[model samples]
Target: MSSAMDIPKGRASYKKKDGILTLTDDRTFLIWSPMPANGPPTVSLALDKILNLKQTPDTSPKVILKIIEKPKNPDEQEGQSFMFQFTSPTDARTEANALRDLLSQLLAEIRGGDPNVPKPLGAAGGPSAAGGPPPNAKPPSNRWYDDDSLKADTQLQQSLLDKDLELAKTHAQALALKSDSISDESFNKQFWSSRVGLLRAHAFEQHQKKGSYNVLSTVKPRAENGEFKLSLSPEQIQSILHQHPLVRRIYNENVPKLSEPEFWSRFFLSKLAKQLRGERITDVDNSDPLFDRYLGADNSLGVASKITAAQHVPHIIDLEGNEENQGGFKSGNRKDAEMRPRANIPIIKTLNSLSEKIMADVAPADLEPSGTPESGAKSFDDARVFNQLSLQDLHGEREAGSIRLNVKDQTKFFSNHGDGISGEDAQIYAQQNPEDVLFEVVADLDTFDDDGAGGIDLRKSIGVDDDSESDHYEDATMSGIQKTPHVGSRAARRAAEQQILEGLRKARAEHAGGPTGANAVEASPMGIPPDLTERCYLTQMTTTEFLKQFWSAFLSSSSSGDSSEGGSAAAAAAAAAGELAYHVESLKRCVERIEAIAAEAERDRLRAAEARKKQIQEHYQKTGKKLKWVPPKGGRDSVMALFEHTTAAIEKAVALYRGSRG
Candidate 1:
């Protein structure tokens, strides 16, 4: 029977009769009973659907359950109750009571409340000390399962209803604002109004794709097995046509006569293609008879010159214009060994045209014009560009100068140790200074007298003979059986050691009394005074401000055209002359300031040197030892070095201004 019931492996059958009854993990009450000859037998109900449960008090306790069943149609009334009865006697009453309590708890949990609350069944039906309901007592209410008042507070329901109403009202208001009809004009206007964001995204995408590959460079013929083939994508073809309009014109003129593949094959072999790719072309290169004729077409159109003229670059960076100003000397010459002029006129024009087209396509549409008519149309000749090219700060006067480093103790500045020199380091320095040792060795060598033989007698001079020294060592080795080898005579060895020690001592003494010594005379302070430094800074800043103003006025006047043309031109020329005079005055003042600072620094240097000399004499008297002193090298003071450059620049500016005035 258990096998027939298909009971799951772990679930226990709470009751077994003609069949078994079990509750699944999912809270479904399952019953399997033996069927009549004509009917199917099992019934299942979810525990949550149970409306009421009762246990009869008879010897054969009857467990009665009223459960709500699902309706066939959604619109039909819900909570259609069905009755179920299970009869077993003796042990069934206790089991039924336990099952009733469990069902109540599970139902309470499913319905959301404390499980300890009394069940919906009457007091008599409950499992507490109070018994089951009277047999004649009517059921409480037919609509008990549908009454939400029994489950939740009235206030909560009202609040939820109000929220739902508010949400509906908001939705209705939004719907009322929406137009019922959408016209073509309105749709177009709306789309175009919001298209800026889309256009920006598209432009960004295009810009990312632009530098990936050069169309002309990538279109090369490949050698296959016994054949040459060139394949171009649609995009590559369109790009080539756009970049090289001359090539496109030739293609259009010749494509009808020749097939597309033949046209491409001939085009790739032509000198025109090589020129377009910026490759050097000679008479030796393979040329197409058909496309060779179109080589001069780009030059005739003058596209390169036109494109160059259209560029709005500043004068500082315009190399072509500078070359023109220099009488086209570089353009005419072919002297550079490393970078030979490989690109011919046609190739240059093609490249320029291609660059112009590419820039026009990629540049933003809403950009303001770089040059305006009212500003003399000077293009990019603005203060920002001038400052950037000249490496000058635009607002240098506003920026604070760096803090000066004031080191109080000059001795500590050059000390090897932080506070003073260490004895160990001094010894190392003495040993490293080989000058004394070298001089002593040289003197000893000079004293050697020539022997009768070709070489001087080194052993005689040192008072050691090779044979006696060897014999002495041999006798000593035999007598004591010693392993120590004979190096040299003890006297000669002692003399050499004494010489080395003396040289080291002399070197240490010199190092202790040198300029870097602890008691050495301090040099005069070498830096400019704070007040002088501040004055220099202010002068330079004033000069820079005047220079900027002068340049602006000069450019404005020059670009305004001939002063003979109108009263405005004459007025601009007068203003420019005034700015020129102001600028010249500022330059002169700046040069004077620089010279004054230099003169002051020179005087300070002389005073410091004199003071240093006096201190050195005082030091010699106190210590009874003369310290080694090196005089400061004579040269132009660093401050005066800038004076020459400043004067030269001022002179050039004056000459240029005079020439312009003439």
Candidate 2:
């Protein structure tokens, strides 16, 4: 009645012990190795050790008990944790749910009615009490604010500034009429230099904000092939006119003669009007504060002034002239007709002082945005603790070598051969040799060891097959003569080394002399043996004839017997060595030819690809149409084609060498 579910072999390290689990009303969980007549349980854990439990029920059912282990003693290090897993019998889902409910009740009783303990695992599929998250759980913090919201606010602020500038122009015109101490000439001069200049500067600023300016027009190039045009909305055109009074004045004077679009288009395209459209004014500080004072929405400005301006200001739009009205000004001389309205100075001076006072009383605009949480906090430690799992400490401790398998008492299984060499000497030897010692050892051990019988079996002690005939010359050149494994004792190893040294010395002496069969064949002018004369004479024989000559030479070389002299074995070995040398030379020439072909193919592929890319770019420039890119054949394809041919040649070469040896 007190037993819990069974623990599987994979989930728990029962380690030669029975995986039986038990739970009692006293809140103790026991894992017994095996039941004895009168002994304590092998492992016992209190209910407090468990932090949470998770259950998974499917074709295979499991229960995961997350343990928050307490230190057995005060001297123990930090981060001891355990997660025990148990499996259920048939009717897994029902059994798991019943166990979960019982555990939840037990947890509640242990906590003495505290509701903050985690709910039992299987509750995920069931309906919960009519509430959201627990009150004790912390809410998500706003230290990392949304970047998109900040960007949107910045754009909105810039748009609001543009609207304010438009409203100020109408206010300036209204103030010109109401103030008696100011003349129109003085007011117009200052307004044109400061307010109108800043408007042009602001437009250029907006254009720069887009990262680049297209010289032809503001319309950006699109991916598709199509003609496009940029146009202004009615609201944008109105704002433009309010900001530039002269453009409005010229358009009004000509409105009776031209349509609105035609008049504005002509004005914008005209050379003289282009000169007045914008100025490269970097220092807005030198200009008057007329724009800021007349239309700023800051609270420091007088409420009465804002209210009066809002109620009484007439928007400064150009008055379109009729035939009778046009005649009055149209009849004038050229100089008189060109005369423009001037700004009043006293009204402008009064506005500057008022703007200065208002700005001084109000808070300055914040130039810098709020910083990241780490940077904004007075101390880094003041930042909130976000790690709620209480398990990250376990990972760090485990990596630091805690909970390692104790193998100190086990006997050594392998001897260290390199231990005899000092560390510095080993390092120096390794640095001098580019090839790794481990590969050298493996290659040495790969050769035929001495069999107890007299005949050489040529079988490896390590069970590796003999090296392929194609690799014989290359392996000899790169790795030197491979050593036979020295079995038995130190005396046996030394005797084997001495025997190998003697054989190498004798072979070198014989090789330095001509090969044993050299006297039997006459050499051609190209230094080819007479046995291979027909194959080597490219001008005299066709490829088919050369192949026939090669096959005959291969058969003769293989069938020929050794001389019956006292040095017959050495002479036979020498003839075999000569044949091997000839095969190696042929392989070298084949490799060179293959490399040349591969290189030429790669260069041609690159040139073709470059030409194709250039054609695409030119087409795009001529038609403004972007085409989907089609790649040329890569160099890998060309190289692989050459590789296939090279591989066949190598295989044939190896077969010929093997046939000759046979």
Candidate 3:
């Protein structure tokens, strides 16, 4: 039995050739007569190409194998078939049956069926001689729907159509559609108008099915009535626990003793919460007695020790261990300020914990587990380290010489005869009079005043006015009373000092009845009343808070859409739509608040202005002297200015939502 097979030529014809049959490792059947030359087998056929196998019912049982022949050209109408017969009265039938089973199994596998079970012989789905059902036929459908279920399905589709119609009507109204007639053109116009909302709604529905990472910053507590309220999703809860193991520990310990809601309420107000949130903790900050006890649970030093224990620093790069020998001195253990334990130990611990969590989450799966002996050994391989430490030979290296200039004519290369100017003209320009340059420098220097003592007088150099110069001179003369030699003429200095003293006395007498100088209250910028300013600030903050919530929902609903088909996807879409609507309403209310605040501030300003004017007139009539009145600066204009950007932002959001619906 030969194991090797020869590559057969196109459609070989056999005429009762005596040969030994054998199957090769690659599933090729071989048949060849042993020749004196000892060449390759003459007949070879692949298992995959065999279409059918059967045995002839004769005294000498012959196995007939039908196989498809490869076409020489792709455009050939049909492939040819070849039949091979193997005779052996005793075992031909058994071999034919086995071969048929193998071919059937291979066919099943090619059609993506169970290869272990051989398929039945004959064409699939062909009618039997009795015209009965095909072999292995599936049972008839047992599923049946009642009228009520059918009605429900019909109603659902009708309701969806009604919703589309309602959306169309809403969009038409927004577009200011004047016609009531439902013509084809009008219907198309309405549909196109409503298409944007339909797309947005579809997108919103799709987004709800996707999984999103929890944003810790968005999980904030709001003050409702006198107590703080917080809402946390299951994912957010898991995220918090994963980020802060201390919080997880506290919750595990205290949950059975305290109700969940009460525990969360206390946690939000605790010093531990403030530390976790990275807020500065002061003595006056609100604290929970029970929760505050766990404030010191996260030790920075302990975390550092854990981190150090989990790291495997190779001896070759161990900075801490080799610090003593770094500078040829016995250096004591020292760390940089950032590397040292921080004053806020809990905060530092939280930071380290978060960093470790992030690294673990993002690290590749292929990396070996940290702090393991095997991992360390693989990480710092001796051969790799040796290769890295080996230095390249520099002694045998040749230094590159400077580039050589191959100028055909050195005289031409040195000449400045190209472009605009000739060599003679350039020389003449360079050699021009040095006196003119000196004259220009002298003219520029003349702007500065040379004080006989090597330094220029800065006041004169900077062009100080006459009044400022006299004031500076007066100050210098006043200082001259202490025997300063900078000021000239003692008599002149004394006269200036006496004049200044007289002017000061007159100013003090004129403003004796009222507060003056530093004591006088400065008017508010833009004449805006303090109360109105505070109200504006509050309104702005409220608007900002609303905007944050609005965008969060908006973004969450605007992300990737769900392509899944089910009741779950439909439910998710409905929930997302409701959330988006709630946030949009919030933004609209914030805009309204802004307008109301602005109007109220305006009314108050008008009333205050009238009262102030009445008082001023009465005082003027009684004293016969017009008192200087600085009217309150900012009124409605200032209030509006404060909220202009926020109002515009809200308006833009409202318009966007409106446009989307339209």
Off by over 4 Å in 3: 1-311, 315-317, 320-369, 372-375, 378-525, 561-564, 628-630
The alpha-carbon RMSD values of the candidates against the true structure, listed in the order shown, are 42.3, 39.4, 29.3
Check candidate 1 and list the clashing pairs: 124-131, 124-132, 124-133, 125-132, 125-133
Show the lowest summed lDDT stretch of 10 residues, model 3: 142-151
Model 1 misplaced stretches (Cα beyond 4 Å): 1-213, 282-284, 299-312, 328-366, 373-381, 388-662
Q: For this target, which candidate reaches the highest TM-score against the unseen true structure?
A: 3
Write down the TM-score for model 3. Answer: 0.27
**What is the clash tally of candidate 1?**
5
Q: 1 or 3, which is superior by TM-score?
A: 3
Candidate 2 stretches with Cα past 4 Å from truth are 1-552, 562-573, 633-636, 639-646, 655-662
Q: 1-662 in candidate 2: lDDT tens per residue?
A: 32364422221323333343445333435333222302223344555444455555455545554445545576865335644454335443554455555666665565532333455554444443655544334344322143333233434334535577543434343333323443554333323322334444444455452211212123122333553333645545543443334444454455547765665454444432322322222333233332222222222222122212112111121122342356543454435554675344333433443343333323222111121221242222222222332457575534465686867654464456778899999889878755577778767755657676754454455343334333333345467775554343344545789999997764443233223455532332222223333222321222222233234445555565444346776687676566455444545454554455446555756786889889989999999998788655424343444245444656686576765557
Tell me how far the alpha carbon of residue 573 in candidate 3 is from the true structure, in angstroms, after superposition: 3.1
Report lDDT per candidate: 0.53, 0.43, 0.54
Q: lDDT, candidate 3, residue 313?
A: 42
